[model samples]
Target: MRYACPTPGCPTTAPTRTTRCEQCTRRNSRAHKITLVCGPPCSGKNTWVAKHAQPGDLIVDLDALYTAVNANPTRTDHDQPAALTPFAFDARDAITNRLLHGDHNLRAAWIIHSAPEAATRAEWKQRGANIVMITADQDTLTHRAQVQRPNQWGEHIQDWHRRYTLGHVDRTVTTG
Candidate 1:
């Protein structure tokens, strides 16, 4: 019941059912390989995920879902913070629930601002998820965001940038 680490380099041994060594596994099993692509709003998380992930990758897009719910296809009100939290929580729940189903063919990318909550990460890990983290700088994010939604205002972009930069989201990839 032992194996090698899949994270490239680091000659670490892991349990057969786990991707990390015994100690690493104990520490990380509670953490899922949930690739968090965090950056300011408009950071191209969607574009990056679309380009990088394969066909079966489940994309949990809170913005998209919100737009659909509000019937606002253009996302004209994304800057309104008060309007986004419920949508975010719903998206998180949806992603977590899907991951818990234990379907190996389900690869996924979530468009979230920061790393998932510990409980959510653990749920994904127990369901055998591999996490990866992707990020970009403020300038890159601002440009992408602007390009993606030309009609949106600068204040929106600045707000997202500030939040992301302040949060300091670190990325990691874990595979089971």
Candidate 2:
């Protein structure tokens, strides 16, 4: 069976066994459904991903991908933010290819904090995904993140609070 290439610029026929043609296979192999969970750091995105994603579900975590790209399984140094950007793009590309190919019945999530995230959310929705935005109040988020990691909440807590105050989050679902 043959399938159409999901990427806009690519003109190729994808096989049913694989969502991508030979030219795109390497990138398409990772394609799947994306459920973006955007919030401040420690906003339970990982917890939600763990809870909702099934066994075959793909998880495109920026942090994890960054660590993998850096070849550091244990990225203990929090100050090296610059080292993570390239890996983040690689992971994003992989995830985008997967979404285009529809290679797996994927349920994935992203923890974002910018306008670009909104665009990403729109793109996923256009792809016929069920976008569920999860949100919580500043105090609650701080409390949870503090419970999860005491020292890490300094910057992320303020960012989340600011985003919440500015109403940056859209189509959000408040959950306990």
Candidate 3:
């Protein structure tokens, strides 16, 4: 007994009921796209995702997670106490791990991170993620930090620029 691959336009066949051919199976598994928006603090990573993301899309952002866990309903900014950083990080990791599984009901997943190392971007690529680097000049970022979070975010902005290295995924988006 033989079974034809159920995938449309796929001509492969198997001797047993293997739902789809190897090629189609691999392609299907990667149907859900994971996009990582990376850059320094105040680089508009969250804004970029907000502009592009649609309903049913999963968004994993540490700052947003932190705000949620902070449980401050009146909070209108991304600032969170340093004590809650670890907890927010753990939540982000859990969500990211689940997204990496490639079996979620989400249409797409967007992760906002400050990934400054080539190795980090390479790993994300290996896991079928698209890297989008949102950036701005150092002065602009520093100024934005000062205006937004003052002493809290300026150092992080400077650190990101010092460590960032353009990798194979050079989809850079300059933001104001």
Candidate 4:
């Protein structure tokens, strides 16, 4: 059973954290139906998913999963999994794969993203996934970031704006 790296932009796969390649995590496979929720941080991706996702609808938000399993849910740490540190992304990716394949009587899935490259979005679109993007001006992003995260939300917003250039998408929401 080969697993995939859930971390964005890192496609290298490994067996497990113990024996898997030092690149990405690995786990069971299912087909992949992913709805890419594209937006900047603090742009209401989590809020939108919370409002939209019904029960039994698979949600693949990495930070939320990490928070669910960790004492400090808000801790934004990735890649370096220490002995007993938080490393729930493996589980997230595995479950996401299952959801995409519609395993165990699954239905739709929501995947929150931070401005995926156009090619990446196109790949998912080809796999029969939907894309939802929440966008706003830089000022709005900065204000929302201050209200939501305050520490680095502004930087993340800038990053998203700089990275987002995809032309074709299923839906676009202009958030203010």
Candidate 5:
């Protein structure tokens, strides 16, 4: 009898005594819907996910993860120390690997990241992820950064703009 693969989004059937199908073992298929939200620091990627994501859906945001792992209680989003960046990224990578190749009960996952390269976007596409690009005018981004983010965020915005390439994203959202 062919049994369904234990991996979350994999569709192949597994043989007897196997925990996952051969394809799944090779990490060939995605087990669920993965939406990759890409944008500058203050572009409302988190807001967009908050508005669209439903209950039980997995939402992975670096800032949120940083806050969760941060030692300080007074630190807010985007104010995390540089020392915590690696930990936050490691956590994100682990969760992303699980989403791509492991078992889970969630139906969908929303990943908030500032992916500014075409290669990164293409990699996500190959892994069966839908990419969404969030953007705002320079003035709007600057203004939002000044009000909502630290002074260094202006540099982040500029860096995103400098590196961002308009790739084959599934959706484009403009937020002021």
Candidate 6:
């Protein structure tokens, strides 16, 4: 049974569970098509996934993870403490790494983030991710969030823009 290497640039297949040809395995295995979605608060990253994602497709969304471990599935309260964030990140990474290396059942995974760091985006791109960055002007984003959370949306949007690194996004969609 020959399995094709899922790595981005590798073109070999092998009869092994490592999902890599011998030569490719000498360095590392193939990477999976992990799509990372980024945007400011209320930029509709979740809406995009809800609109397009197929059932059974894995999604790594921080709010969803927070919901999983807490009672309120609608919001992540600010008072929930900083420790939970890192814990959820760990779980997300473990799932992503395992699927990237071993699982053939899933064609791809979606990761939702406000990831403004170039290094983080580059790391995901190198790991075979297609970045979908949804963008909107500060006023637009603030208006979108004002209906729900008015006090903090502007700051979050500013932080995201401040940390955003140009030239990292594979696909950019401007909402406003």
Top lDDT: which candidate number?
Answer: 5
- lDDT tens string, model 6, 1-176? 88777656778887865666765553333345578898777788888877768888888887777656665556534223355778777777787767556444665578888888888888778766789887787777888767655467668788888887765889988876
**Cα lDDT tens digits for candidate 3, 48-158:** 999999998889988889888997777657777788889998999998877765556677889898999988988787666889999888788888887777476887877
lDDT of model 3, residue 4? 90
lDDT of each: 0.51, 0.57, 0.80, 0.64, 0.84, 0.72
Top of the candidates by TM-score = 5
Model 5 alpha-carbon drift over 4 Å, by segment: 1-21, 25-32
lDDT of 1 by residue, 1-176 (tens): 66777644437776663465654444344335445554445545566677777776656666655655674455464533456668767876776555443333444444354433444334334444453444556566566656655455456666644543222224442211
TM-score of 4: 0.68
**TM-score-based ranking:** 5, 3, 6, 4, 2, 1
Pairs of colliding residues, candidate 1 = 1-16, 33-130, 33-131, 34-131, 35-132
Candidate 6 deviant stretches above 4 angstroms? 1-32, 72-83
Q: What is the TM-score of each candidate against the true structure?
A: 0.50, 0.59, 0.79, 0.68, 0.83, 0.73
List RMSD in Å for every model shown: 9.2, 6.7, 6.2, 9.9, 5.3, 5.8
Candidate 4, pairs of clashing residues: 3-26, 3-27, 15-20, 16-20, 33-100
Question: For each predicted model, how many residue pairs clash, with residues at least 3 apart or on different chains?
Answer: 5, 3, 0, 5, 1, 2
Instruction: Return the lDDT, model 4, position 5.
Output: 46
Which ten residues in a row are the worst by lDDT in model 1?
167-176
